[model samples]
Target chain A: MKSIKEINQKIREGNICVVTASEMKDLVSELGVEKAAKEVDVVTTGTFGAMCSSGVFMNFGHSDPPIRMQRVWLNDVEAYTGIAAVDAYLGVTQLSEKSEEYGGAHVIEELVRGKEVTLRAISKGTDCYPRKEIVTEISLEDINQAEMVNPRNAYQRYKAATNSSNQILRTYMGTLLPNFGNVSFAGCGEISPLNNDPDYRTIGVGTRIFLCGAKGYVIGEGSQHCPPYGTLMVKGNLKEMKPEFMRAAVFPGYGVTMYVGIGIPIPVLDAEMAKATAIRDEEIWTEIIDFGVARRERPVIKRVNYAELKSGKVEINGEEVRVSPLSSIYMAEKIMKELKRQIEAGEFFLSAPVERISKDCVLKPMRLKEVKLVRSVMTPAITVEPETSVEEASKIMIQKGINHIPVVKEGRLVGIITSWDVAKAVAMKKVGRVAEVMTRKVITTMPDEPVEIAARKMEKHDISALPVVDAKRRVVGMVTSEDLSKLLAR
Target chain B: MMLQLKFDPKTVKKPIISLATLEASALLNIIRASVGPREGELVVEVEEGKAEKVVEVLKSYGVEVHSIKKAVERDEEKCVHCGACISICPVEAIGFDDEKRVVVNTTKCIHCGSCVNVCPMKALALP
Candidate 1:
C-alpha cells in the first residue's frame, strides 16, 4: 500500500489529461480537448454523452463541470491577528436596544470565536457587482483528518494532494502580482483531470486547484435555458486581465463566486492565486468582437424665416401667414429667437414647447412666517354689566354671535353668563334681571401663564376661554382655544 | 456490527476528530464568562427651577435618582473683610482682596460647603 504523500507525488509527475465531445465545440476549446484526452491513460469516449443522458444522476450530475477549490494554511499567528484587526475596522459590534448603544456581547462573542472563524466580507469584483468572500483558517491536522471520512474525507485528500502544486503556483505568482492580498480556503468543484495515467492514480485528488480569487466580469450566461454550473470564457489580452482594466467574464452559473483567504499561512500566495484564476476564467475561449469608442452626435438645427408683417398677419420668406390664434405675431417674433437659442444649446427639441419671458420681469414668491393670535380670532363672548336687564343680555348674545358673557362690575370681572344659563332662565319663565341667571364663580388665568396650561385648565373645567385678569382682578386680555391654535400653528 | 478486532497496537491518533476538540467551545465559554454583567449609570445636572421638571421626565422614563442637592447662592452685600469665605468655600467661589476685603462669587458656590457659618465677621449668607 502506498502512503498518501507518495500517491500525491506520483500524480504530480503524470501526463496531463483532457476530454472532448463533437457536439461541445465551446467546451473542448476551453479545456484543450485533443491534447488533454491524448495524454491521459483513461480516456472515456462517451463520457459527455453519458453526462447528458443521466439528467439527474447523483455523482454524475457534477462530473462534467470544471472543479476548483481554495486551500488555506493557518500556521501563522499574524494571519489570525490580521482577521481580528479587519473585523474591528469594520465596526462589527453588538448593540443594545434599551440603551441604544454598543455593548459587551459583541466583544465577548469575538473573543470566544477565535477571530479567525469564517466571516463573510462583501467586495466589488471586476464586474462592479458585490461578491461575498468567505475568510477562514483551518488547521493542517483538521485537513488530514478530513481525508479519512466519506464526505469530510475528500477535503483532507484534496488538501494533501494539491499542497505542493499550490506551493509552486503561489511562488510563481508572487513575483507576478502587486499588493497581493491574503488567501483562504474556499469551495471546490469537480473538473476533468489533466492526467489520467495509471501513474496518475491520484489525478482526481491532485487535480483540484486552489481558487485564489477571480478577475473580469462573471455573468450567468447559461442560466436562462438550463441550471447553470458551466462558465463561458471571454478571450482578452493579458494587459486587459489586470484588476483595473478587466471587464466582467460571464459565468453561466446562478451567481458570482468570491473566495476570501483568512488565517492563511501564505497570505501573498492566496491573493496571487485568486488573481490568476480570475484572469484565466475571464479569458480562455471567448468570441472576439470589436469594442470601439462611441462618438457623441451633434444636435440638428432648423431655420425659420419671418417676413414683412401686416396688422395681425406676418410674412416669412415671401409666404404670408396669419398670426397663430394661441400667440400674437409680436410674441411669436420674440419666441423665435429663444427657440433658436434653445435648439443651439440642446435644451429644447421639436417635441418640447418653447416659451419666452420678458427680460425685465422678475418673479416675487410669497412665504408665510408666523401666525398672530387675537381676541377677534376667537369664538366671541358676550360682555355686560351686572346692572343690565336679562332682556338686554339675551339681545346682546344674539347680536354678537356669542354664547358666553363676562359680567363686569366697577371695571372688575364679577361673574360670567352663558346661553345655557339664559335658556334655563327662560325655560323656568323667571322674569328677572341679568344678575339672577349669572354664575358668580368664574375661572380666570393670567396672560403670562403658558397657553398650554390655560388650555388644560379650560379642558378640565369644560369652559371655552379664560378671562385674563390683572393684579386688581380686572379683565385685561382674553385667551381662548383660537389663541392656542394660532400659537401652535406658528 | 462486526466485533472482530486486530492486535496492531500502534496507538495511531484518530485522523477525524470532532470540531469540539479544538477548544472552540471552551474559548467561547471563557468569553461568555469574562463578559460578566453590564454596569451602566448616567448623571444629568439641571438648574433649580428645571430640576423638578427634569426629575419628573426622567421618572416617567423609569430612571431613579439617587440624591438631590440644592445648588449654591451668595449674598452680594454681607460678605466682607476677614477672608473667611475665601478659606472655607470648597469650590473656591470666594477670594480675598488686596485691601483685605473678602469677595464671594455666587455662581461657583455649590452651597454644599457653607463658608457663611465659619465667617468670623458674620459677613456671609447663603440662600
Candidate 2:
C-alpha cells in the first residue's frame, strides 16, 4: 500500500501518475484494483452544483476613522455583522432588501469578477469608535480578507425532486411541474468528491481540494452530514476563484444560490481506495423526493440510479418522466481534468486529514419555545345566546362591522351566524331567533394550533372565518382568511 | 422564421398550436417549450412563406407571438459547456457539440429563456 508521503515524494520528483475518477474506473477494470492502486498515485474527483449554505467572510479593512459597524450591507444585501467590528459574513441566499434577484451571492460573484460594490453601514456611536454611519465602495482587491466558508458542499447522496401536487412548485430544487411532469436532481455522481470517498476514509479536516477555481481545504463535517455518507464544510480563497467555476444563480421563483466547483484528489493508498474511486453512475442511487408535500420530511417516491437520470428519463408512477440535472457534468469533467493536470504537473499534492469527522452528528430540529400560535393572529370573539333574535344579531353585526357571530350555550359554541344568513332570512320572510338562521356544526380551530393549521382548515371548508376555542369549546377568539392573507402579503 | 408563443394561465389549456397549424397550413417545428398548468412558453419555426400567416393566426386567439431574430446572446468566451440547459429546453435547441461545448442552434431556438435563466456563468442573456 502506498502512503500519501511516498506520493508527495514522487510528485516532487515529477514522476507521479494521476488520473480523473472517471478514467480511474477504466484503469481499475483494465488493470486489477491491486495493480492499479500501485500504478496510480492519485485519483481526482470533482462536482459542480448549487450549494445554498455558502457564504464569504470579509474584513473590509477599517474605514478612515475606524467604525464599529452594527449593521453592514454590500450592494444593498445585508451581511451578518455579529462577528468583529469590520468583519462580516455574507450568506449566499440572503436577498437584497430592495429586490428579489440581487443578493449576497451576487455580491460574491461581483467581487470575484473584479467589480466594485457599494458598502454601507450604520452603528450606534460609542466613545471609542464614534461613527454612526458610513458608505463606501469596495472590491476584492480593496478587502483585506475575502474567504469562502461553505457550511455544506458536495453532498454524497443527493435527492432528485419532482412534484405530485396539482399546482406548480417553485423550490430551491428548481421549478417542479405539476403531476410528475419532470424530475430535477443535482450531483456529479461518481466523480463527486464525497462520492469517491463516501466514508471520509481519505477526506477529512484539512484535506486539500480544488474549491471553485482555487486550492481549498475541508474544515469539518457540515450540518445534516449523515455519517459514512457525506457533506463537508469547506473554505477557500475567494479572490482566487473564477466566475466560471463560482458563479451566482437566481432560480426564477427561488432566491439566489451559489454554484461551486469542488474537486478532491484521492491518493491510491491501497486497493480499497482504488475501488472507491472506481464507483460508477449506475452503482450510485439517489432518492427521488416528492416536493409537493410542503413539509420538512417529504415523501421519497423511489431510489433511482444516476445512469437513468443522466439518460434524460426515469420511470415515476409507472410513467416515463423527463429528467433534468441541475448539476453540470460538463463542468465537473473540466474540474476533474484540470485537477488531474495539476497533480501530474506536480503543482498540487494530496494531504491527509488532521482529524476524522465525528460519527455522532445527529440532526435535531430547533425547539422554538416562542412559536406563534393562532391566538397571536386571532381577534377576540363576540358571542350571543341562541335565543337572541335575528334582528338583534343583524344589529350586532352592523354595530361591530363584522361578518360572523358565534352563539354560545353554557360557555360552549353551538352555532355561528353570518350576515349572509340574515340576508337570506329577510329574503325568505322568516325572521326568527338566532338558532333558526345560524349554521350548526361549525369548523372550529384551537388557540394552541399553529396559524398554518387554521389557514388550511378555512381553505378546506371554503369559508372565510373560524372560531378559536379552548378545551372547553368556548369561543375565546376569532380568526379569518383576511388575517392569514395579510400575514402572507407582509 | 422562428416564433415564440406565450400563453397565460387561463389560455394554456387551449389547443392553440394544432388549431394554428390546421388553419395556417404550416407544419410548425417546435424548438423549445416550458409549459406547466399555470402558464406556458413555446418556440416554433414556420416556413418563410407562411411565417406571417402563422403569427396572424396565433394572434387571433390572443396568443403573444414574437418572430425571434435570436433566442439569446451566447457569450462563447464565458460558456463552460455545462449541460444544465440541455434537457431544460423543451425543444432540443441547445445541445453539446462533438467537443461538448454548448452549441445553440439559433434557427431552431424558441427563446423560452429556460437556458438563459439556469446558466450559472451568465453566458446566455436576452438579446
Candidate 3:
C-alpha cells in the first residue's frame, strides 16, 4: 500500500510512473494487479461529451451608477439573476432568443477563448443601488470572477440511444435514425474518469480534477447522481479553462448543451485501485434505450458493452445497426494524455478527498402522470332517425366533420352508415331512406372500456368506428380511429 | 430536386430506381428509402436539369410522386474538430480525415440531418 503523500513525493522527484486508463488495462494484465499497483503511481482518466447540467457563475463588476441587476442577458442569452445584484448564473442550456443556435454555452466558450461578450442588465430601482439599466462589453479579464459550477459533469455509466419507430427522433442523445438504423452512446468506456473509479474511493469533495483543461475540484455528488452509476458536481476557474476542451452544441429539436472535458487522476494506493482502473470496455455494459417512445420511461432494445459499441455496429431487433459515439473518444484520449503528462511533470498532484461523497441516494422521477380512458376520449354520438333521407344523413356527417353516423330508432342505435356508404348511394343513384344505406349489425363498445382495449378491438375488427351504448342499449357516444390516434400521438 | 415514389406490391419487385437512373442519364441519389415487397416509400434526388426525365419515368410507373428538400449545410469556421458529428451521421457523410479532421462527402450525404443535430459547434445545419 502507498500513501497520497508518497505519490506526491514521487511526482515531485520525477520518479512517479503514470499511465492513462487505456494503457493501464494492458499494464495490469502484463504485471498483474499487485505488481502494477506497486509500479504505477497514478492513473489518469477522462471523458468528453455533451453535459447539459453545466453553467458558469459570473460576477460582472458594478456599473458606474451601481445597479442591482435583476434581469440579465449575455449575447441575448438570458442568465438567472436571482443569485445577487452583480452576480448571475449562465446556464449552458439557455438558448438565445435572437438565434437558438447561439446560447450560454457559446458565451462561456468565448470567454475562455479570450473573446469579448456583450452584457446587458435591467434592475428595479433601489436606494442602495438606484441604477435601472446597464449595457457594455465584458471579457474574461473584465469580470471580477468567472467560476464554472457544473451541477453534473461526469457520469459513470449511461444508456445509448436508438430509434425503432418509423419516424426520426431528435433528442438529447442526438438525432436517432428511424427503424434502429443508428445508435449513439455518450460515455467514454475505458478512459472515463468515473468508470475508472466506479466507487468513490479516491474521487470526492475537494478532490482536484481537470475540468475543461483547467485544474478543478469535485464539489459534491451531482443532482442525478446515484450508486452504481455515480456522477460528480465540479467547480473550476472559467478563465483558466481552454476552448479546445469546451464546446457549444445545439441538439436540433432539443435545446443547447455544452461539451465538457473532465479528467481525474487516481493514486495507486492499493491493488484494488489498480484493478479498478484496469477495467476494460468489455466489462462495461449500457442499455440501448429506444428514444422513439418519447416518454419518461423508454423501452430498452437490448444491453450492449462498449466493445460492441466501438466496433461500429450492434445487433438490435435481430438486425445489425451502426453505432456511433456522441461522446468524443478522440478528445477524451487527448485529455487523458494531457493529464498523464501533467502528473509526470509534477505540475499536477493527487490529493485525498476532504470528505467522501454520499453513497445512499437514488434518482427519482416526477410522479405526476395520467392514464387515458375510452369514456373521456369518446365524443357524443350524432344520431339520425332511421326514416331520415340519405342526403340529409350525408349533410349531417359533412357539417359535423364525422365519417360515421348512427341510425337510431326511439333514441337507441339500430344501424350505422359511413361516408363510404353515402358515396356509394350517391354514385348508384339509389335515393332512399338512411336505413337502406346503413348496416344493421353495429359493432358496439362500452364507455368504461380501457382505451387500449378499445383500440385493439377496432384493429381486430378492421373497423374505424364503434358506438358506445349503456345497459339499456341507448347510444351514449362514439369512438373513432381519428380520436384514438390523436390521443396516442399526444 | 427530390422525388418520393410509392412502391406497391406490384411495383416493389420491379427495378424502378435502376431504370430511372439509367434512362435519366444522371445520378439519381437515393436520399431516403424504405421499400419492401409488401409496400413502401422511396425518396430520390437528381440534378435539377435531369429532374424532368426522372419524373417522367416515375409517372410512367403510375406511382405517386412528390418533391421534397432535405439538404444539410456545413460552416467550416464554426467547426472545432471536436468530432461530435462523426458517429451520428446515418450515412457516414461526415468522417475523419488522415489528420483526424472531419470531412463531408456531398454525394454520399442522404440529407438525414443526424449530424447537424449532434454537432457541438452547430457547424452543420439543415436548411
Candidate 4:
C-alpha cells in the first residue's frame, strides 16, 4: 500500500481525480482495483440525520461581574455547567422549562440562525468567583467558541421499524400507524459515508469532516461500535468483509435519531481503500425490527438490502408494507456536493486521523439505579348528581373549565358526561336530564394504578377521560388525557 | 387547452358549482373534477379558440384557473432514493424502477404534490 505522504504528493501534483464513495464502486469495477486506486485521489463520504447524542460546547466569555455558573440554562433549556465558570454543554434532548416542545435542539437551531438566547444561571458565590446569579442574553457570534463534540455520531447501518400490534404506538420511530401502516427507517442508504466505508481504518480520530454545514473532525469510533460484517463472500478480518455486512446500533427510546458526519479522505493510496469506497446500496443490508413487542430482544421480521427499502416496498412475512426514511438523503447529497465544491475551489482540505478508534469496545446495557413511580398529580374529579339537568351539567362543565363530569348517585359514579355528549344532544334537539344523555357504563381507574396502565386503557377504548373510584365505588378523582400529558411532560 | 381549476368551498357551499347561476356563454368541457371536502380541483378542456371565454366562465363561479404544469418533479441531483415520497403519494406515480431509483411517472401524476410535500430531501417539486 502507498503511504499517506505519497498519496498527498500525487494529490498536490494533480495526478488524481477525486470520486465519491458511491461513484468509486463503479470506477473500481470498470478500471479494476489496481488501476482505479492509482487514478483516484480521494473519496468523499457523507450522512445527515437527527442524532440525539450530539451536543455543543460554547465559551460565552465572562459577563459583567462574571458568576461561577453552577446551574445553567439556555433559553430555559438546562445546560451542564460542571466544566468551568463560563463554559457550558448544550445537549440535544434537553427540553426548555417554559415549554417541553422547545428543547435544546430548537435553541441550537435558533442560535445557528444568529438569534439571541437567554442565559440563566445560579451559583453560590465563592471567594475566587464571587457572583451568585446571572441572567443574560447571548448569540453564537457573541460566544468565544461554539463547537459540537459528540462522542457518537455516524452509524454504519440501522434497522427499519414496524408495528404489529392493533393499537397505534407513539415511539421515537415516529407514530407507527396502527397495524403496520408504514415503516420508518433512517440513514443515507447508498450515498451514506459510513455505509461507504464499513471498516474503521479510514474514519477515526482527527479525521476532518463536514458537520452540520461546518467543518468538523472524527474524534473516535461512536458508542455501540458493533462488529463489522460483510457479504457472504470474501470473509476474513473486519476490513475484508463487503460493505453491506457492517452494522452499528444505539438504544431506541421515544424516537430514534442518528448523527451524521461527512468526511473526505485527502488522498486515496491504494486499490483496497478504493474498493471500500465503492460500496453500493444493493450490497448494504439491514434488518427489519418489530417494535410492537415489548421485550429486551425485539423480533427480526426480515433482512433486506438498501435497494429494496429505497424502492418504498418490502415483503415481510408475505405482506407488502410501505416505508418511510427519516434520514435526509437530499441533504447528504447536498453536503457531499458542497464538500466537493469546496475541495475543487481549494477552500477545503483533509487531514489524516491522528489516532485510530478502538474496535474492541462493546456496548453495555444501561442499568437503572432505582425505578420508582410517585403519584401526586391526579386531578380531583368534579361530580354531578345523576338527576342534574343537561343544561345545568353543561353550565357546570363550562364554569369549571372541565370537559368531563362524573354523574354520581350516592357518592358513587353511576355514569359520565362529556362535553361532546352535551354538544351532540343539543344538536340533535334531545332535551333530557344528565342521566338520559350520560354514558351509563363508566371505565374507572384507581388512583394507585400505574400511569401506563391508565394510558393504555385510554388508547384501547379510544376514550379521553376516566373517573378514579375507591373500593366502595365512590368517585374520588379523575384522570383525563390532559392530566396524563402533564404527568409525562415532567 | 388544459387548465387546472381550483374551486374554493369557503366561497360556495353548493357541492356542484354548475348547479348555481351559469352564464353558459363559454363552452368548456370538464374532463375530470376531483371535489374534496375543503376544496375541489378540476382538469378542464376548452375549444381551441374559446380558452379565454372558458376562463371567464370558470372565474364567475369563483374557480381560480391555472396553467397545466408539472405536478411532480424529481430533482435527480438531490434524490438519494430513500422512498420517503412513495408512501405519501396520493397517486402511485412515484416509485422505484428496476434499477431501484425513485422515478416519477408524469402521466399518472395528479399534481396533488403530496410527494413534494413529504420529500425530506426537498428533491421533489411541483409547479
Rank candidates, TM-score, best first.
Answer: 2, 3, 4, 1
Report every candidate's CA lDDT.
0.30, 0.86, 0.85, 0.68
| Model 1: CAPRI class | incorrect
Better of 3 and 4 by lDDT: 3
TM-score of chain B of each: 0.40, 0.65, 0.57, 0.56
CAPRI-style class, candidate 2: acceptable
Clashes of each: 25, 2, 0, 6
Could you tell which candidate, 1 or 3, scores higher by lDDT?
A: 3
| lDDT for each residue of candidate 2 in A393-430, tens digit (9 for 90 to 100) | 99999999889999999899999999999999999987
Q: What digit string (tens of lDDT, one per residue) describes model 4 on residues A264-372?
A: 4435666767777777788888888887764446789888888887667788667788887666565566567777765655556667777766656465777866322
Top candidate (DockQ): 3
Alpha-carbon interface RMSD for all candidates, in angstroms: 46.0, 2.7, 2.8, 7.4
Query: Which residue runs does candidate 3 get wrong by more than 4 Å?
Result: A369-377, A380-394, A398-490, B1-118, B124-127
TM-score of structure candidate 2: 0.76
Q: Is candidate 2 or candidate 4 better by TM-score?
A: 2
Model 4 iRMSD vs. native:
7.4
RMSD of each: 37.3, 8.0, 9.0, 9.8
